[model samples]
Target chain A: MSAWGMIKTIIFGGSTLAFFFILWFYNPFKHVEHYEVEKDVKAIIDNPWKKTESGKTIAEEGRELFVANCSSCHSLRYDGIYIMSVQTNPKWKNIEKTAGRPVYRYGKLYKDRFFVPKDVYEAFAHDDLQSLKASFGQVPPDLSTIYLARGEGYLYEFILNPQKVLPGTSMPQIFNPQFDPQAKEKVAKIVAYMKSVNTPPPQEQFKRTVMGVVVIGYFLLMGLLLWKYRQNLLKRLGYH
Target chain B: MGLISKFIDWIDERAHIREIYRTQMVEYKVPKNLTFPYVFGVLALVTFAIQIISGIVLLLYYKPSIADAFDSATYSIMGEIPFGWLFRHIHATGANFFMAIVYLHMFTGIYYNAYKKPRELVWIVGWLIYFVLILTALSGYLLPWGQLSYWGFIVTTEIPGSLAEAPIFKDFFKAVAETIVLWMKGGYVVTDVTLGRVFGSHVLIYPLILLALVGTHLYLVRAAGISNPDGIEYDKKKNPDKFVPFHPYITLKEGAYVMWYLAIFFFFVFFHISHFLPPDNFEPANPLKTPPHIAPEWYLLGYYEVFRSIPDKFWGFVAFNALLLLLLLLPFLDWSPLKSARRRPLFFILFLIFMFSSMALTILGTMPPTPQNAMLGLIFAALVFGFFLSLPIISIFEYGWYKMKTKGGQKE
Candidate 1:
């Protein structure tokens, strides 16, 4: 073989082997394990709320305030509504009991029945939606998952003065030092309530790890086979 | 004859398919000494295909609206759709890889002097394709409506506003810049309208332009033929032994390299997915709040640094554009008979410096514009321009030395 031909073979073989070794060496499962554990510990340490002067936890005070004030517009039962409907709604119950075959057939219907709020489930949901939109200029978003999406700091600022934080926002300034003396504490409590109700989505470590192994293995095998085939073909062509 | 052969013959007779095939692929000859770097063009095309396929798959679940775009991309697609995460990962990673491979491909072209003489159109078209690809990537980045996407869009689109600060024609330039910025954002600020416009451009407009450019680029490559590392053009009729048919020899080699590329690509897609996804992008876009440090994707960092290095916004914009224009005019700038840097030591060293300086600029681009970082950025940015500006002088001197050496050797 010529010098160039040998270099080609070496590069081809070396890169293929090196990439495969790198893929095998970096175990995604182990990384995911460390990532999730660290995240959980961080979350625990990062909890900001404290007990009030009255011995009430901030989250408890926030929950009471939320029920009195924000509950008129925003519902804290977003995910709960879905879970409750799945268990108690006759239509959903029938679909759930039918196992795989009917579930597949009723997939579209199942999706529709999945996430109905308490007010929507009760009566005149469409009318209620229009009225709510008419009143607020836009339908108020559920506060249940707001904490997960917007961090505590943003939630605090937004709840304290919606207009100040987001100019042109339809949300009214419900809590302020001018209107209420303990407005800062009230906003903090609201944020604490939001944080307490919402949990981040569970880490899919098992699925991701399995996928990483399978995908890496498949590519590694394909690469080796191609390398072998290429070498043989080049040899036969008298190029190697 | 087999039925397939008969059918092929019928098609060939009418369309002259055999002639086209013979001229284009089967009997087309390239230099025998072409090496590993040549495979990057093929890898780039493969990455393009991956992006297109995965991007289309992602579009199925991607909501272009600002309100739902984040959740649709993350919760709906990544969580709900089976192997949807894989497609999203591939699309995201493939975009970065596409830019990476294109940079390598461009470097390979430069190193081999593939942009010289008859291959200028090829380089020009390839550059246009690179430009469109960046635009497409930028537009696509905004589709997720994440924090980085939102802020990055704001920062990038507002770059044109610096034109208003130009010393001359202040009002006219200001009006034009403001209009352009407003038009790009679809309002005074980035919003739902901006998302819609970006989505339209990303999926429909930029891809169309890219495809057209890519087609022209490939045609130009075919017409010009591939340049080799030696930078010596060999006519097949004159020296048939020095050339090989591209069909099996080149295709087989490309296949091996492609497999290697895929292995590394999938490894990142599966294990190091976070490399493509910045943590800031995990959060949905909040127009009220801005990220502390907003930067473009890794590929655009060098240019971003060049923009930041100059304190004046207007001059920085000019410098940024000047760098791109200089790169495009590389063939015209360096007028030397010695095409290959291997034969030109000075050019090779300058090229290395240019490459390192740009890399340094890219690293600096990621950091906050501190005094030290800004100073380093300015230095590297100067080196980058210095390489281009000094190319012609160095090339002329090198040519003179080469001529003298050869003439002296003949006398001896």
Candidate 2:
């Protein structure tokens, strides 16, 4: 057999073997943490700062780190989430929603749209920001009710125990920065920022036209790259 | 007679299949003295299989729509179905296990100069498989549409999101990041739409990529054979028949290693009870709901630290990408003509520091990215980076340092 053919067969066989093994040996969904808003950060990491604003303490320091590392992902909305001692059987469906469905999310505040404040250029795709807008439609959900909406401390716990929180999280480790000593301090400060950010964002007076020029430029480049990649794919697939 | 003739013709076309199967079953050859580290690659493959089978079974009971996605995914595991939780934990834990083995295999290969000479393609193919595994792991994490998965995805994408200001990347940055994420989400803003797409990609697209890579890698290894201890030579005259059949000879050795993998998988599966993130994920992926700390998966610590370490954007990109890129370049690094780790003591020590530094950075990256934290992260990251950059230079310097010390003759 040709070398490529042999490789193809091996891969195919290996793939089949893998498929059977997972079926026999383990659960695929077990790693997926079901969604509930009770943050378990305390359990994941030892957070000296529970809910205090004390300065220079682990709590305050964690807030700084939270802002640096997390603010971008986490909204500073105090009201949107609800924090309580985690109940193992706390009604997962007890979550408040619009018409028995989970309330849809909007982009962050301080921008014209929910997604506008997001770094659109750095998102997974240009349409990603747009689809973000399209998905939620007009009024993005506000953070004013998140703590009440989800719960407090859940966010903290999620951050703290990411692996225990969710497997394959892109978030790297923080508590055991075995090489980097400053990791704990950074997390503390970031958490502090989240705590401090309570007020809802004021209405935007800025142009709704563009956040940065990334939107337009991103389209042109992606179009070209996609086209080139398609051409390459066609060649590889012998489609001409 | 015509029908019989047709059947015979069909059988003839696929005659090679029968032979190929027999060839591996009966006469496949492998090197003797292959070490435990080599088994990791196959072990990862085994775990990959386990994940796929269990994943498909879970899909039978899963509803990928945002409305019931979390619940369905949740029920599929939480022991609602017979042995359902087993499937879920196996796949999830298996992902982590797969990563561990891949890292082990890669690192061992490097330490033994496994990428040198005939095994170069093996190394390259192996790394490609690792890349596919990352993509698979990323997609699988998203399928549950849980709180951690949602926030975790955001954290994972955050750095890439901030790269929008690349000065040159422009809209392509926005378009690429936004669209793909949109695709991952099936819509945007981490909705059911996103969950569905991520599910399909996790189960199908990514797995296909992984399988392809694994196939190519295994073939490459067979074709090139395994790299041995650094000092070993391949002279046909010196040792004509130093190899053994892979089936009975090597498989028996691999048997013990496989047992260890199974034990680890079950240990986490049962005792850990699928240690998923906190319960906030039952709600749909909510953007407004931000988890206070946003750390990436553990494997990416070094790059994460590099991102935190550097306050700047472009440099952060360079440093972050460089950490992994350097691994790909191990073939070119350390040109002291001494191939083995044992031969060059200083190289070995510095490289150990580099590995530890990477591990440290990965852990550090998981924390919040505050300035104080970042500044310290940077210092520590710099120390680690120093570890990587100083290897060859230090390896060179040590040669002189050793000579100078010896010439001084201060020893008793």
Spell out the clash pairs found in candidate 1: none
Task: Mark the regions of model 1 whose C-alpha exceeds 4 Å error after superposition.
Answer: A1-208, B1-23, B405-412
lDDT of each candidate versus the true structure: 0.73, 0.55
lDDT (tens digit, per residue) of candidate 1 on B264-331: 89888877776576556866676777766687887888999989889999999999999999989998
lDDT tens readout by residue for model 2, A118-204: 121123223332444464342223232243224334544544566766576555455554665754444434443343332111221
Query: Model 1, A62-138: lDDT tens per residue?
Result: 76777777766665443222222223446644443343121111012224223332333334234444577898786
Name the candidate that leads on lDDT: 1
- Give the number of the best model, judged by TM-score: 1
Question: Which runs in model 2 stand beyond 4 Å of their true positions?
Answer: A1-240, B1-29, B76-79, B167-188, B274-284, B334-337, B366-376, B387-412
Question: Candidate 2, residues B300-320: lDDT per residue as tens digits?
Answer: 656777876787775787677
Name the candidate that leads on DockQ.
1
Q: How does model 1 score by TM-score?
A: 0.74
